[model samples]
Target: MAPQLDTQTLGLVFQSRPDILAGIQQAADTPARTTLFNDIASFVYERLACADAPDGPASKRRRLDIAQPPAQTHRNGHAQDSVPPAGSQTGALGADAAVADPVLLEVKDISVTAPQRKKYDLCFTKNFLYARASGTSVPVQGIVYPWTDIEHAFYLPVPDKSQAQYNYVLLPRGSFLPTAKQASASAVDRQQPLEPLVFTVPATAPKPGSIGGSSAKTAEAVSDTYSSLFNWALTTSLRSAGNHSCQLVAADPKLFHSVARQPHRPNEKAVHVKAFRGSKDGFLFFLPTGILWAFKKPLLFLPLDRIVAVSYTNVLRTTFNMVVELDTEGSSDGSSTVEKEVEFGMIDQGDYQGIDDTYVRRHGLADRSMAEQRKAKRELVENAKKAPADGEGDASAAGGADGMTELERAQQEAEQRLQDEEDEMEEDYDPGSDGDSEGEGESSEDEDDDDDEDEEDEDEMGTAED
Candidate 1:
């Protein structure tokens, strides 16, 4: 007797990919069948766990249809058809209202730095972190970061702002951005891509003497109280969620310090790079784990594991660009590897040596540009070895041309041949003059033939007289 597979899983596998299920069914042995079944089941589970495309009109209509029955059944209690009775509405909404998330940590008067600058009271709940408008207890309908989705947390310094820093959290790519359930429908409709959680503390503490300063001190104290708690909660959540890859990064000056110097804090070193991503000026922090670019919209964190190599480009006396090449997962069929690049430019040359020694060399991230040049040279040598002997003489003259790609040289040769043909046609073209000269030569030859004929006739007559 053979062990039976789960009927539900088998049915789902068959519905999703019949060929896969068929292969599982036609396995060579019992063990093979079990292995295939397990693999297919796992793949199907992961696929279903991923977020699906946005709900379509048909799905929305179906949901409306399903929701109408309960309301229609309770419509009799209502005096008007347009509005439902309070009891019915409360009953419909009570399911969600019954269980509220317990707040773990609450920080006040925090400001968002990226996407936009807005003041919000940051609340850390057991399952999520919500950013609500200041003095508002009600959760706003907007982006919420779930504890399980957060892959990393960083506490980094603000450039040129002494004793100022910000903390932000990053999510793994392809994860869905959670929305506050209590928020209104209008708020829910503003669905955007998963944005990084970017918030910064006030740069300066209020003076001790004023009333506003006292209030600011209170807010700062509240923020300080929960800062450590936030880190602990996030770490615990990551552990419980079995996300070993996730980390809580606190920038340590010992590992990799910023090359930029601060006159205010000459002894203290920051962990950041003053660089520009397009027109946006931002700071890059080289953490023990990876690099983080922040204080702007589209905040990016490149994990060390995902980074393939770091290469410098546009090298000059004043500034240069740094391009980070990232390794991406291949396609489902595993036919080819994928790569992605993020470039930050206008890095000061003054800070180059320190960064080169501390971050780039310490991490052993060799410059891929140099490697690529060497690879190109080796490829050229190999191509020369394989080149046919018939083009040996041309090859010497084509030394500079050999640097060009095969297609480019071929194109150049084609253009040159075309120009030569055009020049030959220009030299041969005598227009109507050549035609007139040929006509005169033909007339002279015809007159000469007539004279010869007359002479021959004269000779014949003389012979007859004799």
Candidate 2:
């Protein structure tokens, strides 16, 4: 089963990063994180474990079996099964949190200098859905000090009405602090900060490898690779000439961060995303290994507006693709209001090698060399029955003469397959065609005609008697 990292926890983790990492180091050095602070350590270690699990999930564990033919069962006249959105099973997470899975949060480009020197990645998921962070203010001595532990105040946005952006996120300072009470009501009560400090990753200069989606030059570059990668991942047999969706290529730590709404850590790039253009609610997901780009089918098209969550994982250390989801549904004034909707995730190797194959073919030198192996096996089996007592070049005998070799096994399988096809052909009973069932239907039609003739004769006799 896949490990479901609570995005709620991730959001908190994102807010408390640099400090959280610092705290973890301190705890490790002094064993400060005792029983009470285990959750923080759990979050960190589990992340490390996921990264180390190689040959585990994303290492092309099983050869893609979907490439096999689809089987049609006899009891399949009923419609195909559908996933019940209302009653679907989730890993016991909060409903609201699951639905808003950071679909558009980019670690916007890092800044390098003074007016632009501050470096911060803009991390947001969906605009309609808000990402929250609560800053905790722990009372250490006389004054209240912000714990900046992931449990700080919930970072809700303070709407800047004029600017259409929230000016500040309110902090309910009293909730987490210790309070005092007395019989005469003379004891002091702890109060949270009236105004919690609003720490914005100040809009600084874009860092060396960050990307910005606002600029035309930048948007084109970001989509150029990200879109291509997505398209290749969704590569299907329905591929037609000049009929292709804009492929999403993975970003390679360049101009992408400049515009990313969320900048991720060097360690946490083990996630990927898929957008189904045709889904009703709009998207579905697989863990890091579950999404294979080579498995292209209409079953995967996601609607642009319906993406609810993006849980990325670098299950293996080899994570690729830097990118964001863009909301291209432009607004009025003939100008775009929401210029860029960005979030970042990583794709693993099983997905990459598979995706890479299709791309190479498109550019011209792709090879699917297994056809020769299959052909040789077929010829070897055909010759095996005629070989001498001392088996020589028979494909099956060549494979292994030990009573049952792969070549002989394959021949048996092929014979059975042929027999099954013949049975299917014999079973073809066209209900309305010239079969026994159709003959029975024709007999009923003749009986109806005879009855009609008798009725006409009776009417004529009655008229003559009158």
Candidate 3:
């Protein structure tokens, strides 16, 4: 007689049956279908363990407790009688159970809306990362990245809606360049360029209109303080206060030692030291358009828009430094674009903070001021076009007395002036005119006398020859 098969063994046998596996695959609902697959997997694992048992099959099977139900009851008052499905907790304590544990890093079926982009639900695991539309599963996208890929992550606030903010993770292009050599062994093309990636995580709080709310206020305060300090510096300094179009925004007076490094010759280092007392060494200027470091040598100008960030640091509580990060033009090397950080040291700590705040605020306000100025100029031009011409209202009030508008009257006066000029020019060029004719007649008489003398001399010469 065949050995009597237990329920767990029967489950493993069902999984091995091709027809049953095909049926599970063809199931309409994914959740129910996956549950069936998990149940099959759990049963197979238990059956295999029983076969390799140190004790007899009966003892190994008893250890599994396959006949026992879950201690917790369901809302419908039914106990879960089967072994916990794969990817679920069975409350068993062992190395095998621990190895089968799963961690939920993120949830599925949840949509993350991005700025000016479509929504997607992203799922990440230890081995794979994929994204799909919020509800559908027809198309799935995968992301490939190095383990050490660098990312710039920041929170971006949405307008009006308080709870609709987003967290942006910017994966810059070539962030994985350092590990490209290792990745190239597996990649089809070793030299293929990598594109940047942006991932947006939706937030569930009140959205802000702009980033750095408290920081912006602090920046404003610092900027004001720096502006006052600049005025004081300019008054005391011996450097000529050059007239500028815009108001003096901020200034910094301090010494800076520049450390230059040669990329080609890594071992070479050059240090250039200078002092800015406002006389020989020029001071730094923060204008509406850009920031300028004015020195006796050529000045360094960085546009406000090109500036990425400003960071302040204090060294040993003695020296203060301000590092400005700027998005500059590409280098000669055919590498990806990067932000360059320029450091200026030997500044007052308070002044350094002020300068940093001023830099941030200035960059934020760069376009706003220009936009306002443009709008004002446009309004002025429009008003000028709509306003009455000079003396137009008076001329209109005078009615039919002068049958011309102020503009027509001005045109008439202009035409009269032009006519007078032309008449004077014609008179000056006319030979028959009173003043010019007298001078012309005297010259004509002298020419006639010369012709008569020539004719008389020719007659005498002919008579002498006969």
Candidate 4:
């Protein structure tokens, strides 16, 4: 069961992340509070662990310093807030200390609007990416994603919000931590796709000489964070296994030819193809890496290697839908491969030609159902080569004679016997047999005449005797 959020607990939570206080107040039920806390518990625990370290604030500051980008570090002047930026003992923090697992970059107060509406402070380390609740004085409960676990990261524009851009990270299905508190009987086992982690940067940098410039600083911080993740992904084991990298994907005309202007920014062209998944509306981005559906919950990223085919569905004069067939890690019950499909509907027909010519054809992802037919034909050829070795080739091929089923063979034998009896009857019928029938009729007539003469004589003798 989830922990109760009493006054003391709420105080600690607010102390950890003051921004969440508004969310807590907005939450009207117990389930909402449970979900809210569960989201940040991991981050909170990690923060508490670091704070309780025996070496004190010096060790913690060393760890945090590694995460700050160079620009942010200079602007804030670490000399005033933390220990000297010079050589420090990051090793005392223990086995996986900052020395070995140095933080590459960290961005605080990134606005996440999808999957859940909350703000997260993103920290990218050498081996992992961490997202903890924002506004926390000390890092605490948060989720961590290993560098290898991330399939790809996309930096895409938000629909209707022309000025803002958001970053989306895609992971494999079911890789996220489960939040269910009940047993299997009551727990729902429905699909739980790893909702992409979304965060955005300020549309424009802060006004010149603005106080703190937190928004502009966050924008730069987001850039540094993406760079750090990309560099780490380039060296991860996945790079060698399949060449998948976590680089940030943005609009490129070479990757997708169609570029249109937003309603608000008529002069500036952008690659923001609109589409829908179910009833929810979102935008589709065609990047050099793959296709990304963004600024919505259940964001989907389909990479080139996993894509089997792309087809247009529900096509109409004004609109069409794209169905993308993907390869999945098959079931454990001895099935080695499986296919899954996702359909993005209600796309404008005007963009169809551009999408078909640019991405689908270039990637060779167009309809490939004929490939299966060709495979079936090849199997037939192989079976023909292994046919039975006998003069009764046709019979064997038809599953007759040697290969005939029990019921079929019985029916064939019965038909053959009837044919033989008919042949015998035809052979026995001769033209001379008609003469023999005529002779037998003439003999019968002669015997009848003799019997009539004897009856007449017997009648004369009986008259004389009387």
Candidate 5:
């Protein structure tokens, strides 16, 4: 007789699978990997736990949304004060007591939308730490006390059906804005993949209109189409806010502070960079891209001095080390050449320089295909169908109050978060992304907007904002 597997065991047995990892190899396969794996794990667990006997029929199971990341539960219970009676001592304290510093810890992970279907669900690796408890004084070792399990992945859930673009989800090669390299996918392509979660792809590539001197595809690119092409390509991928914000680089988190010194342009993308306020300095995370950020809109007036750190949550949701250094001398241009000398780029957790051909083959445009995609999508649906019959727990380990013991599984989720963020940060920084605020001076987003927009595009921006 076989030992029966329970939901816990089911989750445990297949805990190591990730979309990217599963595609790697079978020897690397874990339990509940395929519909078959989960089916087997489910059957085994059922046989063991069946109330009647080992011979009893197994019960039905359901698919769990592995993508749902554990909610952030701040370990430090900072006291929340209510609005006191007008002019009361309580009111004064609330106003003056240097409001409970909402510290920001930089995570190298970024979150981005897949361009279609998934909300900002990407993740990438970062060298930073997630403290079970808050405080920059001590180094973040690992999960502590109540947080026996550390969640490596996080998803920024965008409002369903909302017009806002949750630029944090990740789409495969032909996904959302699959670069010019990847086969460009359009909206009408219903075969277009949908994330396990719901999301929509941007309808078309934003066409930026005109610019005078440097040749880019300004709507009025005189006769220099090729030069315009080259410039447009860079502008579409690079952030103008001191190009340093999105390049691939590395640095010590403890050293840099304030986006001001680095002075991030509003519409710029963090790019291949993982940024976060180090655990040490208190930070103000300008997480205003979502509904909360749109409404609260704090970055505009928040005490700039109080912001000691900042980072990005891009499409893949990976955390990267974002080191923004401010120079009294000032950066010469917002382009990558000049920007890189400052904060630098986001280096991959793996051997970065060694990331040669092998790396490109794995992640580059070649990775996508119609047949491969169909096969992968079919398998996912199949697994989803059998999920309930198997009674499988979440193969993805999520640390909610539950006693989640699968650290390896948790790591898988974390990886997704990291990778997603990386891709998103970079895409957002594309010079022609048109992400900046309207006429608000030099911001990464604003610069990208100016680079890409034709006189006609400005009207679109206003409409899009609504």
Candidate 6:
């Protein structure tokens, strides 16, 4: 039986390892807090019991398939087995054990630095990128993303936000899976894919107040040059089309970051700076012809046909950052080619829907309004199916040869009541009826005038007698 742990001991364990709680919270379908606590308590109890057992360690080693040393024959002809030394190079043990695994690249001390900065240790193995919070070995918080789902990895820097500075993110290459309702309606063969996840790592930068701190000013100069270029591009594109044919869908004055890096080249270092202006200020215009944006320089006339995909990163409930991947030619070696992606940061929350709508329309995706209509129609059809057919009793209660549901009958009754009330009110306050009321009012006024005259005569007679 598992050892029993008291509440106090369980609380202490939880306090010592807060990552357990964090793991529970990160679950996609998180249980109630009380249930999670109870589960953790039970787990701790079982672990403690296992540790306390006499043969627990040996059993664990056996379960892990740890190899035992060969048995030796003693002078008495009795066989005895020797225990393996600690950290022995036997059966999945020792320093080189991980080498046998399929993991290709593993990097620690990395932080995701876009939308938000989060420390994560990344491991790439067998076409899957596994990520876990830095400094914690908990597998529950680890996420596995397939390489095919990853669209691109690039650097983007935004001003006025610390987390956005020196940021690199991996965006998803495809659209999200069908919603729960949609999946139920259709025969979905596959499970839902994960939402667009942005894995970010920060770039190296000079410390504040250091000699290299002047790089900030240099970044500013670069931003100004880009901004000027952007303005020129916008003017040039608009000039080519003399008529204002391009309808503006959305515009952002200050948004975007540009970074260029060539790892194979010796002198190539990652550059992270505001995109258009020194302050990361730039404009993004969604035009009918396509999308246009400028920051340090303008990316003018990016035709929709050239765009491969558009993805978004939610930024702390305030905004969404857009990532646009373009289909471009590869370098001669092909290996040296970069995946062309543009990041538009700090977009207004309200404009997200419109931008997404425009993207879907341009990319031949289902129309947003049409999708909504279909969803509503499906709901109506489902409700109709769930509703009962008119029974004999229901038809009799309706008292009409035309078949009607309870709701229709109720509506007809309500309309009849309303009509009757309106007719009564109209008769009570008819224009022709108002004339009789006016004549009666005049006769009453005349009678009142005669009464006044009589009272005056009585008063005059009394005065004469005095």
| TM-score for each candidate, following the candidate numbering | 0.50, 0.16, 0.23, 0.47, 0.14, 0.26
Local lDDT at 211 for model 1: 16
Which candidate comes out best when scored by TM-score?
A: 1
lDDT of 3 by residue, 88-168 (tens): 223221212222222112223333332123544443322222334545421231122221221221222222233333233
Show the lowest summed lDDT stretch of 10 residues, model 6. Answer: 376-385
Kindly list the per-residue Cα lDDT of model 5 for residues 42-125, writing each as its tens digit.
Answer: 453333223212122321111111111100101121212232221121111111111121112212112211212112211111
Backbone steric clashes in candidate 4, count: 10
Candidate 5 lowest-lDDT run of ten: 66-75
Q: State candidate 6's TM-score.
A: 0.26
lDDT of all predictions, in order shown?
0.54, 0.28, 0.36, 0.51, 0.25, 0.38
Q: Residue-wise lDDT of candidate 6 within 1-466, one digit each (tens)? A: 2212223323323544567645644551423443444455445534433332333565444323321211111112232233222112232221112111244434554454322346565554333444545444331121444443443232233333433233333333322111113333233433222333334333343223321121234333333332232223223323332423322222222221122233333243222222232256655544333454432221233455556666654332334466666666532212212346656676654454445543444456332222442332211011211224554244333233455433355568679999999999877885765456666556677899999999999999999999
**Off by more than 4 A, model 5:** 1-210, 214-277, 280-466
Better of 2 and 3 by lDDT: 3
lDDT of model number 2: 0.28
Consecutive 10-residue window with the lowest summed lDDT within model 4: 376-385
Which stretches of model 6 miss by more than 4 angstroms?
1-102, 113-118, 135-142, 162-164, 173-183, 187-189, 205-303, 306-466
- Candidate 4 lDDT over 1-466, as tens digits, reads 4333332223322433555755764662675554455345324434544553444776566434432332232223221223221112221122122222344455556665654567766555544455555444333222444444455656555556655554555454343221223435323433222345666656554233321222334344433444343334334423433335445456776567444557865665557688998899988888887787765665666767767787665544356677787766533222222337777898876677577766788878866523553322111111112346565445423432365433455467679999999999999998777766655656777899999999999999999999
| Cα lDDT over the full model 6 | 0.38
Error of 6 at 85 (Å): 39
The sequence of per-residue lDDT tens digits that candidate 2 reaches over residues 325-390 is 333343211222222422223433234333332222323332322345333332222222244556
Is 3 or 4 the stronger prediction by lDDT?
4
Q: Evaluate model 4: give its lDDT.
A: 0.51
How much is the lDDT of residue 175 in candidate 2? 25
